[model samples]
Target: MACSIMVTAKQFFGDPITCITDEIPQKVMDTYCWIQSTFTLPHQLDRVAGEEVAHDGVGSYVDGQHEKKYHKYYQWVVFMLFFQAMCFYVPHYLWKIWESNRVRNLVSDLNNPILEDEKKTKQLKSLTMYLKDNFRFHKWYAARFFICEMLNFVNVVVQIWLVDRFLDYEFSNYGTEVLSFTEMDSEYRTDPMTRIFPKVTKCIFHKYGASGSIQTFDSLCILPLNIINEKIYIILWFWYMFLAVVTGFSIIYRCILCSSPQFRLQTLRMRNRIVDFHILESVFNHGDIGDWFLFLLLARNIDQLTYRQLIEQLDVSITKKTDRESFTISMDNERESKDEVGMLKIEKVDDFKKF
Candidate 1:
């Protein structure tokens, strides 16, 4: 937002374009050229200034003979910057809605170390119970958050490409060309900034003569705005590339960490040394992918000591629950075995009577 505001202030409040003309009123010519847009002669930029073209990108628009590269998006630069800024928040917004406050409910105010002991213990127990009961139900919840992260990576990539398109495919090489320009001999070098964003261009205004014949007026226009534009884009080009690389790598690492349980276990241990390794492994083994993901999130949000206690409590609760289930299944099997023995004895007695 700040970036957009700055660009907007300089581009609009300042005179974006100035035209030299005696035939047309100065203000009228400036506004007309700015609104209608201006074009540069691409072929003339390479020619020697004094011997060929009078100035860089300066020459005749004779019968529209020269290949023209119109300065199209200078007027829309701020709006584009604003759009880019807004796109970055889209994933965050989706996650906010998708999250549904599940994390908040689980984390509660437990992270606050100054809480009353009784209230804190009560909340901790409640959190443990919730995790114990809700196991295996939150796969989509954790997965959805990761999907939003993937969207964030995608957003970065899209904005990079969008800027390239906005600059007529010049943005991809803008930074590189600028950096390498000094290596070339001065006689052979052309400024990439000027090529992508020209300070001077031409605009044609048409009118009718007193005799009613069509008359054409050509004007040489100066754009001081491109100075600001070149600097802004060079900074942005490097920023976007760096951001893209980091975000992309982060997404790949997350995908690998989530896919491999060993990596997840190692990460948990690395983050929380107080938690028992055996407990972590036991709970992690029994739980599905989503459970570990949510647990990891809780570890980040909750206070360290509290999180250790919470993990211990969860381990105890799961252990008891599993033991009860095992006992019930064993008792049922024993009862079935006794019933089978009784049925066999009854059948023996009936066979003995028949004999």
Candidate 2:
């Protein structure tokens, strides 16, 4: 994920962004770019992020020492299941609200071809047109939504079961290790504190890998736990992939809906402004794409990761162009000031001064 994001940032920023830490596997990058280009974001629109202005530095150190340590959430799995159940109720409520809104607008204007002078009437017309064009789209949307909800419910159950089993097995093995220590010669025990040492050592090895006093122990003792962890990891991969597919689909759907020229223009304008602000902020902050990338990488590494982490990682890359950033910010601010004073204004190309 980190490598993919770095590639994206490099494309967007129009400069080199290194993977000094190699936090992301090369195979993962290959799969990510292939899947993203094949099934999700096309290369054409992907160019937009590359053209945007970047923050001050393209690559820098990522500090994560202050970040919270990853913790398992065996209990939160129940809430995930509950949340999926609640989603079943949401669509119906949303349908009622949408129907009422539509009805209210229709009642206010009986004429089929309403006057364009009324803003509310124009909105109703737009809504009608949008619905007419998208009704078929809605059916597929609802079907996908329901399928995802049901899958989430099933996943929550499976995740909770698997995680709990893994934890129990881990602790059971630790208990065996502790018991074995007692069997060894008392002289070899070294100290009373060493009794608690094995568990702490185990966790440290899991995170940092034979570093700084918590070196690897006998492989025979850890082989079973390592095998169990690997199985748990395989299940986690599919879960992560499912989440990524769903999120990528959602981004695609949104792009589809916003493909209209007006919407794209507005989105482009808005994106430009955000990049500008970040770059100005970056001049003083000196933070680079790595800060954002690292945050996302850590988030992805957590036990129950979400696609939003990946999205955010890509967002930094996609929005890395500095020129677009400055232009957008300036244009938006200009438009905002004009709107604030109740005077209609459209900016001319000459209004922007070259830096």
Candidate 3:
């Protein structure tokens, strides 16, 4: 009963200390405390960062008037780069995973009428013939499959290099404890503070517009600087793995989402048309009939021939729907008397947004 009350108090007021009352169950409180301690990153990170102002001190390599800059500039640059890589890129891949899941649901809900469109199939054949006469499928596949795939691979390699560089530099300044001993020795032995006494007052730069001046020349050493103790390697390993998995999942899931049953049927019809017209075999000499069929299948809006050309070449009447709000199209036979006319009512929903 006390454990429940303590948990309730913490849940209501947002303080874990409430869970520590003597009335509470010891086991429950212990578990809660352990969880809280394990999951949170160190709050000491920022405090240690402020104290280890390597560039602020007088004896530091870059702090002298002749040096013209802070020694910490390089460290800051590296830290910022790594922060961006971890914060921005990791979330980016996670967001892609979420997007893929959403798109997959959207595709599953879309509607298609290919099952009822015999006239549409006939009209598709005519459209295919016209495409054969006009466009070469081989050229498109050469660029899309060969060129784009190679570029994507190169981009992945470049991303890995940049991320590795950022990580390496960001963590280097952590192991600088030996500098503190050197600074202490230089301050006492090298200079006589008695005779040439400039003002002995220590003024600290308050970068945040506060009145407190920083002890710029203070020799500070960062404690527990080892990233291994922090389990950063495990975190980074999981982060990179998640990124790769999400990227691959996004590509597959996006394809599935955009190609709803209706979209898949449309693709199949396009492929069948390409095959019937002999465009797949003639234009793309490198690809087999099946390969060209798939290429045209996945490609959107691939009607390389006009309605007039389709009619003249294949004796079919293909008509597009007039509604701009919908992506629907239709095809019919002008001469053949059939009660069932082919009417396609395609809608460009959210699933197809990426494509």
Candidate 4:
């Protein structure tokens, strides 16, 4: 969308104004020809021929010719802008597909509160078992996630290269240039022309077959569009660089988190502390953390051997609590019976025992 907006602005408002005149006076052409004649020697025909060849080889010494080349690739620049934006979004689309198929279904089953306690426990146990048995799937998912992040980094790098290649100068160096804050003076740093776009340029046009002679016309023009392109690319260059840096860190963090045993241990300790694990189903169902949780689930599966140990510990804690409750209930029942019997006996046996 941003790319589209920039392209539109360039087409309508960024076009350069061309210089116009009623006609080139005959006196001006006569004077130009006289000046040209003075710079040449008709007697030295070979020398003049060699000089013309050299001049052509050196390519358009006039400023107008040089500026003409700048506008030639404007179409290519706009095409790349839209292409780069689409490339950056590819990873996100892949993640969405994975989330919809696998993560959402699992979270839904786990979070269904209407299910009987035994069925819910069975479901959790089955999920844990599945995770333990399918360790390879976890590793594969982690690798896929890492690849997606690296793709983002690659997209940014490619975009930076494209900008430099097309602009062919320090114009695309805004990312690095912005770092040297202390070295740059205020006027150059703040100059709109320097940062916004290239405005003033010379353009040359040829009038052909005019009285069987070619005439060259040069004029100064303003390319308002180059300014818009400059500003858009400068911001895009830095934004992509920052995104790549963040993605690199996230990949590292995910690798470490998934590979370590600590994460599983932490999950085990925190599992029972959750009052409503079902509420977290919605969180895993959507949002940024959903992908992370999917990876975590896969990681747990990979270490099923160790994860089963945590499950055993959980089972032991549940059994101990159930036993304690049952013993307390039995003691309470026995005490109540004893009190009722003693009251019905009228205390005759208590007096005999004291004697």
Instruction: List TM-score per model, in order.
Output: 0.91, 0.20, 0.29, 0.55
| Candidate 2 worst ten-residue window by lDDT | 197-206
Arranged by lDDT, best first: 1, 4, 2, 3
**Cα displacement (Å) at residue 288, model 4:** 23
TM-score of candidate 4 on Cα atoms, chains taken together = 0.55
Q: Model 3, range 1-355, lDDT digits (tens) per residue?
A: 2222322343343432222224335455444433432111122112222355211222223233332211122223325435545544443464454335432332221223332356555545644544443333334433343333343434444555554454443322222322343466542432211111111111122122246654222222221111121234334435555555665665564356334534434454454453443432223442333333334433323333332233233222111212321342222344233333322112344336646
Query: Which of 2 and 4 is the better model by TM-score?
Result: 4
> Model 1: per-residue lDDT, tens digit, 252-347?
998898779899888888878888899888888778889888888898998779988998999999999999999999999999999999999999
lDDT of 2 at 200: 14
Ranking by TM-score: 1, 4, 3, 2
Residue 295 in model 4: lDDT: 37
Predicted structure with the largest TM-score when compared to the true one: 1
Error of 1 at 307 (Å): 1.3
Per-candidate RMSD vs. true structure?
A: 2.5, 29.3, 21.0, 18.4
lDDT of 2 at 98: 40
lDDT of 3: 0.34
Which segments of model 2 are wrong by more than 4 Å?
1-117, 132-137, 168-355
lDDT of each: 0.88, 0.35, 0.34, 0.52
- C-alpha displacement of 48 in model 4, angstroms? 37
Regarding TM-score, does 1 or 3 come out ahead?
1
Show model 3 residue runs off by greater than 4 Å: 1-115, 169-355
